[model samples]
Target: MRVLVLTKPFGALPPGELAEQLAQAGADGADLLVRDGQTVTPDTSWRIAETAKALRGNGLELRQVSTDLISADSESERVIGHCAEAGVSQVRVGFYRYDAELDYAAGLDRARRGLASLAELAARHGVRLVLALHHGTLHPSAAHASLLLDGREDVLVHPDPGNQAKEGGEHWRLTLDVLGGLDRVGCVGVKNAVWEPDGAPGSWNCRWQPLADGGVVPWATILPGLQELGYTGPFSLHVHYPADDPLAAVRRDLGYLRGLRSGPFQSEPFQSEPFRSEPGTAPPAR
Candidate 1:
């Protein structure tokens, strides 16, 4: 799998400078952030092709994008269309919140409707709408995304094991089992986190950690697990942590992950549904 760094943190650098930095960091490409005023916003989406060309000149592919797109509105369509024109196949949309005021059923309905609309837009544009397994939202696992999208092929799930390690953590084995096969996985979130004490008794907080030592994310195992499942997509490294020296940190992460590519962990493909019983006997795919 190739390594792509999320360019959200290094917005301070201009696009050319950013591409240079990523090339220095040994990144295969960048997951460009698209929003207002930074680089490729909806209003300035006409630059998609040009920007991709510039990044390509720097030896980095700009085929994947990260955006704050929760709805499939006209403006979103314009941006996505521009991405399609630029040959960008994957666009990571934003999260759907599970607000406290809304019931679970209501929240699911809202998220599913929005995703369905976005899926239609994706099909029209010939670009895949990518959804990350983000925590504290309607999605926190691969199965959650598949269920929400109803096994749609036009959309793909970006599985973030570190985010899942938070409130909605799950085993990697089960995540791939019901993930609608490997084709549903557009990319994987490459990062790790650790929960630490919050000073108050029985209280703790989750913080982003490097992918090196002293982290809970089992990359050593998940790398091979993904290979076992025949997944050869990009490993988008979301450096969701503060670093004194950002470039050095990114370089370190790239090197460490490259070392982990050889680790072996055998995984068995699922034979069938793990649950088979009456309606009341088995849990629903809510």
Candidate 2:
């Protein structure tokens, strides 16, 4: 699988500087998550064009533009145009909160509409939309995401293994089961969180840790499983620990990932597929 780093880790840096640092960090590319006034918004042609130029100048390609900005239908179109201009082929859209107490059917309908809108925008820009499953939301689990995307061929699912820790170990397997049959899963986010033991804390504090640190999610099991499941998409690295150098943390995580396959624990290939797709299946037409 190819390795990618998200640009948000270096949010303090200017876009151009961040792009340069990512390339220097051995990243194949980066996923750019955009936000405005505390809310994530869709892309705009101007923003995408400028960002693309910045990334290209740094010798890095814009692999995906994450839709973190909340915008109206009219604004989404403009954002899609920018994505196309910026050369982004994939887009990740956030799902509604699954943890909320709302009418299940109504929530599903709302989600379906949002997906439809985002999918149309992505299509217009020749990009694929991946529905990212996040915690404290309506579709936190892979099963829930799968169900949410059922019958929608245009939308993809991104299962965050680290976040699934909130549901415990059993749910990890359940996540794989739910996402197994999807035909358009374009990427995976690898991260682990350390949960404080039992009731000894004021709050259930969690911290992002490198892959080998024995964080809640089992990377050894999940990473290979992802490979076996035909997930040849980008393995995006994320380091969200506070009070730590984000880039250094990400580099350590990357090192750990590389070691897993190189050390004595060397095992079979992560995925059995000879390539990302079948011989006859062409990549989605732009």
Candidate 3:
């Protein structure tokens, strides 16, 4: 897996400056942010080309572009077209927030229809649309995410473990088990967090940590699992916390990931049980 900077942690900057910043952070690829207050937006399609050129000029590649929730089919098509034109491979689409007051079934139906239309457009443009596991959304776990995109290959899941650690967190082991078999998983978002006990007796507060420091995402386990599943996708580093020096923080986290990738972890055998009996060990007709 290769490292890709998400670009949101560096605030809004020109494409050239953004590329330079990522390069300084030891990143060779960028997952450009296409959101409000960023270099590109839904209305600004030309910026995609401009950003791609700047990244290439700086010896960097455009790994992916993240966009907000798609409420319209036309907008989704336009975004996919622009991304494909810019030579970007994947586009991370936003999610539909779950509201208890509204009709859940009707809302899901509408979401499915909109995504189906968007998926068709994405396929026509030869671009993959990513739906990440986010909190308070219709698709929060790998299993649920798989259900939403059902039979679409163009629309894939971008699993974010830290986001799953929010309010209703799922077991990471189960996440790996389900996502490993799914062909629709294109990328994985690297994020981690720890919940601190606070407020009431049973209450807790979340604190986002740098990649390897967090207690939430067991990188030691998940990294090997991903490798075992033959996942050769970009691991976009998402620093969701405030830092005195963002570049330094990212550099440290990047080093951690590199160590894991290049270390003996990948070569070690994966065992699911606590005790391992010797191979071919049989208690003589017991």
Clashes of each: 0, 15, 0
Off by over 4 Å in 3: 171-173, 179-182, 264-286
Between candidates 1 and 2, name the one with more favorable TM-score.
1
Please report how far candidate 1 places residue 243 from its true position, in Å: 1.7
On residues 1-286, what C-alpha lDDT tens digit does candidate 2 reach at each position? 6777766667646566776677676677777776552112343246666666777887777787776532337777777677777778887776476535678888787777777777777786788887776776666777777677767778777777776665553344466666775355677777788877457757676656666576877677667665656667787777666525766766777778766544443244434354466888876654
lDDT of 1 by residue, 1-286 (tens): 7889987667546667788888999999989888765556667888778778878998889869988888889878998899999999999988987787879888888888888888788789899888898888878777667667775667788888999988747777777677756777788888999999989999999989988754877788788877866888999987778887778889998888988887666554445566668866867685
Provide the lDDT at 261 for model 1.
Answer: 82
lDDT of each: 0.82, 0.68, 0.79
In terms of TM-score, which candidate is strongest?
1
- Candidate 2: stretches off by over 4 Å: 37-45, 69-72, 169-174, 198-205, 228-230, 264-286
Order of candidates by TM-score, top first? 1, 3, 2
lDDT score of model 2? 0.68
Q: Which of candidates 1 and 2 is the stronger one according to lDDT?
A: 1
- Which pairs, if any, clash in model 3? none
TM-score of each: 0.88, 0.80, 0.86
* lDDT comparison, 2 vs 3, better candidate: 3
